[model samples]
Target: MSLARTLLDSAATTALVATMALSAPSARADEKVSIMVGGYEKQIYLPAKLTEALGYFKDEGLDVELLNEPAGVDAENEMLAGAVQGVVGFYDHCIDLQAKGKFVESIVQFSQAPGEVELVSTKHPEIKSPADFKGMSLGVTGLGSSTNFLTEYLAVKNGLKLGDFTSVPVGAGTTFIAAMQQDKIQAGMTTEPTITRLLKTGEASVLIDMRTMEGTKAALGGTYPAASLYMQTDWVEAHKDIVQKLANAFVKTQKFINTHSGAEIADKMPQDYYVGDKEGYVKALDAGKAMFTPDGIMPEGGPET
Candidate 1:
């Protein structure tokens, strides 16, 4: 299949990256292929770290090194610069890049939903909907990150202009929480663990939940495919064997996620991912795990939606 079709027909995946030289494949025996993850600790991209913890990459005879980047857009820049072989992030970047004459494609879709939740500070109980976002600052992972894109879509769909609200690049995890605590952003879009943290502290409430298929359909009109393993088109074409190995490993990870309970999956991740609250993390994962696809395949019409 054409690379573009391969990307479009499948569910959406993560952000933009730098250009590559199409040099020798990094899959040679004993050589590690580095894949940048847009916030590995975030539940949306859990499969990347989970696969590593499970030794799935080794099972495929691939020496893989997973790196973490809080912002997908920054990870995208690293990929374009050939700093990493691929990225585990939101898939909307492929379409956005394709429109700009750059080519990237998702090799394995990890989730059928965006797995993001728009959270409004509890201090702003008057803000009931996107319509109330005017004059407020919203948090996104980066200025051009997937979170930013979705935030804009929500605002526009609610009849607000781009200038109506400010988008702060507060990134996910601790930084995201800090932003909320300090009043840097009135509301923002973020993934799990962090979502659970805020809600646990009674600091924020769900303004628009897009962490599941039903929530995605209700908030964005349909299943918004997200969180995938993606690579530059040329890289995928040049290293078909390596790409296949990655696909195999990631697909296995997705299956594991499907078959296991949240606590079981949590046991495989690094302890720090728990954010010092193991119980809360497990509960949050259980609530949000439905966002992951049973198989590493994009949902129908995910790209178009």
Candidate 2:
């Protein structure tokens, strides 16, 4: 087996054993944990739905409700407003929230790369690079999402000021595809299977690919860990048992991803997630599966990157 798979297996088994030994009161029977996932259908956040489909949550004696929100920013808001207990979204949000005096932490570091691609509409071939993004409308999941952050960072790195281009919140999936099709945006950053959908249609071509560690380092200079299961620190402190259970479930799911074939993992996902192209979805997952961390541990120097 691969190192990642071995580490993930070891971590999952260790966590389960540790949680089982805990003497803290078990989760309240009446309490159902709700997690809001940002674009759960997107392969970047697949573990959320996959874990649910695999019945890992129930196996841990936890009633977990998986909610879907297309935008990570909105998911963050829901968690802050108490609508959800946790968010399966970008790890950057935890850092962003911390700057504003909020305390949230990533309990499970899902992926070491952003799994995002900056695609330029095929109609705009003149846009060769971020340097050409001046006056362009860039699509992001939301105004304050990690997509937006990366968009701005790219723009600045390429010598473009924030005012030089507009950041449009076109959301993801169908809406994101719609924006590109209708020329609502010239270039945008998004995750798969939206990236695959757009590329398959020849509507967009990649300008910057952050979906893998090498691509991420080339674009952003180092490993930029993205998807994660993050919760408010206070809530985590008060619900150690529940947090431990969640960690166990997600770690197992990560191990599964590390070991299984793309088609095998696809079988565990919702049929609708295939977006009418099950084969394409499987192909895309296989291409980008390396972005996921095998051990559910944050990559070394990832946060600093």
Candidate 3:
């Protein structure tokens, strides 16, 4: 089978990456492979962070460095600039760049669905659904980003044209919270921890939650592949073993997260990722745990659905 097909069909096992000893040495054993991720703390990309925290790359004899960029496209740009070997970003990017003739390939699929939720500030009881979105200011991660895409999709799904509601780019972390706290936006698209924090403060409530695959399918009308490890097709071709090793670690990490408790998994993550409330952070993580694919493969018809 072709490498791409091999990876796409990796749902059954993870032995593919262990063939490092048989690999042609395109990269030195000590070479550091930099992976740029959209956001480090969002629960959607937790497995990527978990792979790093558990020393999975080191254990596999691969030196992988994961850099965080709040906007996923920024991480993709970093890969294009030769600053990173791979980008852990939304799977739609592979299709986007492919259309532009760049032909990026997703080697490891992370989440089967977009782990985002539409939140409306408690102050605006009148703004309940997208029907009420007309003339309201909605928040997204950034213009032309995944969060923005979801926001736009939501707008269209509600039978209102894109411009009926204005989308302002309010980021995912603290910025997302501040937008709600200060009432800068009536509704916004954000991910976990931020979503969890908003509810804890009683300032925001879930207008549309897509943290679960079922919720994502219901909200987007299909499965929207969220996070994955992707790079230029040429890059993967040249560094097959290195890429495979990284994929192996992530597949293992996903399994670890599935079998473990949220608090135990959170313990492996950076302390700063927490919402300053341990219980809430764990609760958020638990809510989001089901989003990760067990074998690190995108589900059949994942992007299409």
The best candidate in terms of TM-score: 1
Task: List clash counts for every candidate, in order.
Answer: 12, 0, 2
> Relative to the unseen true structure, what is the C-alpha lDDT of residue 126 in candidate 1, on a scale of 0 to 100?
89
Local accuracy of candidate 3 as per-residue lDDT tens digits, 1-305: 44344434332222233233234233335678888888888888887889988987877788878898998877777888899989888887776665565657777778888888999999999987878999999988877788877787787888899878888888888998898788889999998888888888799889898999889878877777778888777777787767777776777787898899999998988888885877888988887888887777667777555
**lDDT tens string, model 2, 125-204?**
99999999999999999999999999999999999999999999999999999999999999999998999999998999
Instruction: Provide the RMSD of all predictions against the true structure, rounded to 1 decimal.
Output: 5.1, 6.0, 4.1
Q: Which candidate is the best by lDDT?
A: 2
Predicted structure 1: lDDT:
0.85
Q: For candidate 1, lDDT tens digit of each residue in 200-279?
A: 99999999998878989999998887888878888877787777767777777888999999999999999999989999
Clashes of 2: 0
Candidates ranked by TM-score: 1, 2, 3
* TM-scores for the candidates: 0.92, 0.91, 0.89
Stretches of model 1 off by over 4 angstroms after superposition: 1-30
Please provide the root mean square deviation of candidate 1 (C-alpha atoms, Å).
Answer: 5.1
Q: Pick the winner on TM-score between candidates 2 and 3.
A: 2
RMSD of candidate 2 to the true fold? 6.0
